[model samples]
Target: MIKQGLLVRAAVPACVLTGGAVAGGVSPIAWATGLVFGLALVLLTGWGLQRTGRGEFGPADWITFARATLVGCAAELIADGGHPHAWLVGLIAVALLLDGVDGQVARRTGTSSEFGARFDMEVDAFLILLMCVQVAETAGLWVLAIGLMRYAFVAASWAMPWLTAPLYPSMARKTVAAVQGVVLVVAVAGILPVLWTVAAVVLALASLVWSFGRDVVWLARTRVPAARPSAIVAITRRRAAPHHGPTWPAHNQAA
Candidate 1:
């Protein structure tokens, strides 16, 4: 399964390089860079996935990474002017859909790991960042919200380190992240409005807020109860007798 996955990743760069070479117009630099980038991506992911599998490979991680890379590579091509020549929209859309699946796979397959989680997250973040950069070139700087949202969250973590914990996946948050890609792809493809760009930014921010809140709540509630207080401590806090008579009366000798 891992080998097959690596093969799939390699195909993208191979195709890009072969096509770029044949075109003979775009800089060989771009094609070479794409190849190197793709190679590095595959190597890094391949190693991570392998180590992850040492614990166990979840079907969801495989599917999620596959879908992410497929959509990601397609998005890159479309954003770079390989548009109209391929089903870039559908490609990107599929990637967005898969965003929700890998975690499911990981959970179901019992293959979830910290390494896998971070690995998958970084890939997703980079792909969105790539899309945002491409869109911003023409859509203006605001379009950058799509990509910068992750970085902004990372920045927030520096201030409040608590932001990093229990970053569990949420459907609403996933939807918001996916929208950033869809809006950028469609907008760049000339199908969406410039004003809609603002909506993307809004959703991205909202997701960050929701994620932070959810984490805080989860952390607050998930604490393991400490062992029942020692019997001695419990007894010390208890009164020896009910207050049938007022102790203050004795001190004052009023009665």
Candidate 2:
């Protein structure tokens, strides 16, 4: 029933976006891409909810869902394959602004959970990636690094599980992550000169690299070492040792 509700809720936006695209005379390919994105979003969200044993979407999850829908529309615009339209920029801006909002909603509504946080983060990452694809057309391919960095880290975590360890909260990390979206939006908006846009993207990428590098280093440093057989045996012995009074000085020892 919950999944059925989710599908019903998701279909509204999907249809609206598709209808808008078609009405605006967007290419079939672009609207089709939006549908594909919407479908994937629903499937993934449902899978995540099932994995986390969540039966209903929280208030913040709904906000994130709205943001995801906007992103899907933006993807359609970006897929149209030209300079971003004013509407595209507006959609992304709203999505980015809502990024902060969902968290606040989650916290205030007491619906915050691991699943919600991960869901928000993935949406943010995807929006950044979608913008990168748009900006890269003009800003150069290097701009892609800013978007792909998080994904690369995720892929690396598969090989080095330590990379998946939770990171301590840092304002700098959050600020850098936020900057990527803002900068990409500006770049895609074409508000700045070509050179300036490229430069802004470069700085965003650098900050992202620094933030991720710091996290990687911290994860590496804090990772628990796997115990060897000898180490395990020694630890077990220490744990199993019987407690006794402290040893007396040699002079006081019994003969």
Candidate 3:
């Protein structure tokens, strides 16, 4: 079953790349970049799945894989950057819409896993980054910071291992993550007046700053020094054990 999911993952990017090239007749280089990006996502995700213990791709995973394909296609369109078509915007809109559906499907289907949740988040981040790049031409380079902040945080983790600490989930973090994609897509699509677009983007960035700032402070306060791999494993195991709390009725619960 996992193999089937992997095959579907492979096919999606191939079809997207070929279809985009033939349909748009745009820059081959940009198409190639999108293909590479899509393939890389699939490969990286395969590794993540391995880390999740063992399970085949569930319905939610397939849906997210499809969403990731749309993100890759949108990235290609943004790379060429001639004019943003309604269709490219439409594609992104669908991807954003699907974000909500996957979680519900995961919970309903009882197949949620650490890998699935992380997969969804990484997809969200990449989409925001792609859209940020798309909007930067009109909104200015500062807009790129919205997308780059997550990557920046990851890089900072290298110098401060404390930054690598897992945060207790917050609704604020999820809300900010969702908002980043929406405002950036609006900004990229040029759907509003310049003033409104700028305002929305600014608001999005502010929320992001607040969200990340909160996480950083939390991680810093909670971080413990890891002197050994065994210590790290113990920390992870402790974190992974279930908490006593009310559980939701569904296939799986969203964090």
Clashes of each: 1, 0, 3
- Could you tell me every candidate's TM-score relative to the true structure? 0.60, 0.84, 0.82
- Full ranking by lDDT: 2, 3, 1
For candidate 3, write residues 97-211 as lDDT tens digits. 9997899999999988888898998998888888888778788999999989999999999999977655554677888887887787778778799989999999999999998
- lDDT accuracy of residue 199 in candidate 3: 93
Give the Å shift of residue 165 in candidate 1: 2.1
Query: Which runs in model 1 stand beyond 4 Å of their true positions?
Result: 1-30, 46-57, 75-79, 155-160, 167-175, 178-182, 196-255
- Candidate 3: regions farther than 4 A off: 224-255
Which candidate wins on TM-score?
Answer: 2
Global fold similarity of model 2 (TM-score): 0.84
Q: For residues 63-173, could you state the per-residue lDDT of candidate 1 as single tens digits? A: 755665564455446435644533555656666677757777788777777666776788678767766666666667766765776788689767765445443335655
Comparing 1 and 3 on lDDT, the stronger one: 3
Candidate 2 lDDT by residue in tens digits, 26-56: 7987878877887898889888988999987
